[model samples]
Target: MKLTRLITFACLLFWLTPVAGQSLKSGAANNDEIIYHIFQRSFYDSNGDYHGDLNGIRQKLDYMQQLGVTSILLTPLYESAFYHNYFAADFEKIDPKYGTMADYLKLIREIHRRGMKFYMDMETQYVTEDSRWWKKAFGNTQSPYSDYILWDDKENKKPSTIVFNLTGLRGYDGVTRKITTANLNSEASKAYNLKLFSYWIDPNADGKFDDGVDGFRLDHMMDDLDNKGRLPHLFQTFWNPLLAKLRTINPKIKIVAEQANWFSLGNEYLQNAGVDGVFGLRLCFAIRSFDKKLLLANADSTLAMLPPGKQQVVFIENHDVPRFSYGVKGDLTKLKVGAAFNLLMGGIPAIYYGQELGMTGTSANFGATDANEIPDRQAFEWYKSDTGKGMALWYKQTGPWKDQFNDDKPNDGISLEEERNDPNSLWNYYRQMIAIRKANPAFVSGSYKTVNNDQEHVFSFIRKSAGQTILVAINLWDKEAEVVINAGGNAVNIIGDVRPVLKEGKLVVRLPPFGVGAWELK
Candidate 1:
């Protein structure tokens, strides 16, 4: 729990100093964050319920601190019939399975006490049949909440569904529950959302935000709700107004939206919507593909889309996407490469839980059910045997989803306990990369520019902040490569194995297969 300030020497190229315990002031710049995204149900369990809870997260702060993340983002914790807690049954109440409201408050307070921020994931667009609005407004035209739930019929016999006209979704409990979209245009619904958001921003309305979440992750945010063409101009009408009001309560409350379209650069959201950040999905896909041209193009366009005071949450894995290790077939070298790009890229980097340990899982096709995503959201492996006191195997021996769980293996070096002591482990690589990033300003809040290289297999770039410049090169191929960068500078090796050599007017570096290198230019 000892905290020390990092001192960087001009002559030294690499410094593996830990900055985890450093106290970050509240309302810090969005670009200053390095987030760790967690799916609580798959994380550690404090009790004997086989399910991860708020208290469980509070117990793992030390683990996250050692991993060098400044913020924590949890998926929805609201009461929901689904296992992922997306389709809320009640927006105001915390899911009983996760814990009580008191537990949530304690968790948030503990996060803030450790100088770490917590972002709550909210999907207020749709609710299940158990929701108060749906129960009261589904069939009663005279109900005061009649306009709260969107209805497709004048007689209120049919309710509006979400994307693909999904009237109901099968929960992990093997029960299909009907879902209906909220009437976003209804002033009553808008006011209710604003009140709900305000409550979470300052739970006790004490003006101080230490007890509440520092921000929110708006799930599946879009101007046109569900792309059904029924709701339009929501950016100008619904989001902007509500977010603007929330800003009045806490000007520093950060809101990051998940653009509905994965292919989008989220420019429209940044321009029109009152959001501080959005997921850099295009760059993430590009990095996963390991295509230099695609990576360069996406990186450039993604960064260019951000206006001042806004940021892109650059990440390779999330609760919705397949684990990055699965895409690479658990290749250690490739996983390390991913870690480098995730932390060193010029954006607000986010590390998904278990990503540092190279956990592998892919989305499975289980027709018309949310269970298909359970593979990607399996329990966190705490021990080498994948069984421990705090292990949260909530879905174990459940069904097809459990059969497809490909994340944990005995002695597979994919658990924190296995990787913590190994110097060359994916976990250590992530820790070192994060330390290097935190110690260097260029990697944290720098301007990114692609550095031309001679080898097609190597991708090179420079991150410059103030007067400091750092050159980074990665060999994406499966063989060793010696690449010559066009930039002329005397570079000192920093984080990776590649040693830069200056010959004539260019810098040359040799990289092993799937190797990443960074140098501080003199």
Candidate 2:
């Protein structure tokens, strides 16, 4: 596809321009500001056991520091039989597959030493059958937690009988019965019933539970998995206050909830519930929209939906979801556009481990075969190091992706190492955006307004905080788009060299396809 450009004012005016009275912020402004995501144990592994460990993460301090990341949110590192650690067997100990308590503390120290924060993903629901609590709850008698977990067993006679067949859920690997709701309140349930608040913060759990990780990402926050209310009092009633107790151990911790489908009920519950932030599902969709109008529409809608004083965890890709490559079907141009949005737009941005470099996967049923499920789970092809073979390999060697290699066709000819060195690479684009966000508080904590523009394909917004103002504009169409910024103020373009001069109270901007521009009030 050819890019539309307009030549005016004696300069090549490509898509993307800046306007005035807008606020912007980037990593350069705050040394202690960052948002990070933890994924499957494939980022770094010293044992070569095909699983990433806490110590392996310790080895990559320089890489994270280079990105100017100030916080890390790890996936379920606490012990569990499941690969994702969403099924909790032991809430206190780090999974043996990942590492030990010493390794976890070392990783924490490493992150804190660099002036960063740490958090983990948590499953507030069931535990693995092997959990001591489950075993102790239901002895030899046939109980709902019989094999070890007590569901709300509504169907069975004894109430102890488990019920299965939950729709839209990827069932766990186990024996032959389904767990229903009737068993939850059964006589057998009383012994092993795990309350959401009591599990993770067990002060006396030196023996079985007690993984000393800081913070938590309430996994599947919007799901009614146990037949609870849509929002569930489990979190609002119990977990929120429980976090306060956990905070006694470390006061500076942070918590982000993974309420992926929260848009259905609105975000008030999450924001008002005292979480630091919730996943930005709407923003993720905005990045995926190749159409400029759709992009702006989604972006505007999301900004409108968010309650004041609350934050969204904006990310291009996450472990549980398909990557941008899958969404764009390996289209590099669209992928770049998505990355631009993730970095430039409002909210705390997070990048999945492999998203920086292009990785590919789809929603095909992997069946019992784990090899070909999602692209995000695929191993790092180190030989195709342009996109980041060494880092990818490091992650693969340390993670579950070790067995799947992409040797024949490396998705993109750029690696983390290669892009970091190239000034115009996506890696640097991200750096520039982060720098802009850090430099302007308006971008970080400012209120936003959609700039009215005559062009349908151009997206423009002003971010203002305190006395600072920054303008952000993007071209969604392949054709050149002319936009008029109505806000008052002479602004400097921070993303690139393209700048707009205000004349007669209007700043006109021309943007090329998939282009991004940022303007800061001078």
- Which structure among the candidates has the greatest TM-score? 1
TM-score each candidate.
0.93, 0.77
Best by lDDT: 1
Over the stretch 450-481, how does candidate 2's per-residue lDDT look in tens digits? 77766777777877677778888877766666
- For each candidate, what is the lDDT? 0.83, 0.56
Off by over 4 Å in 1: 1-30, 397-406
Off by over 4 Å in 2: 1-32, 139-164, 167-214, 222-232, 247-251, 260-262, 329-333, 368-373, 380-412
Model 1, C-alpha of 321: deviation from truth (Å): 1.3
Clash totals, every prediction: 0, 55
Tens-digit lDDT string for candidate 1 (1-522): 000101112111122112233222211133668999999998989998889989999999999999899999999989988888888899999988789999999998999989999999998989889998888876789888887888999877799988767788776557889988899999988999999999999999999999988899998898999789888889988999999999999998999998886667786888899999898877888888887877766776676445767788989988877789998999999999999889887788999999988998876667667777777788888999999888889887575566666567788878888888999899998999989988888887787777799998899888888858999998999999989898888788887656788998999888889888899998
> Local error of candidate 1 at 25, Å?
28
- For candidate 2, the C-alpha RMSD (Å) to the true structure equals 9.0
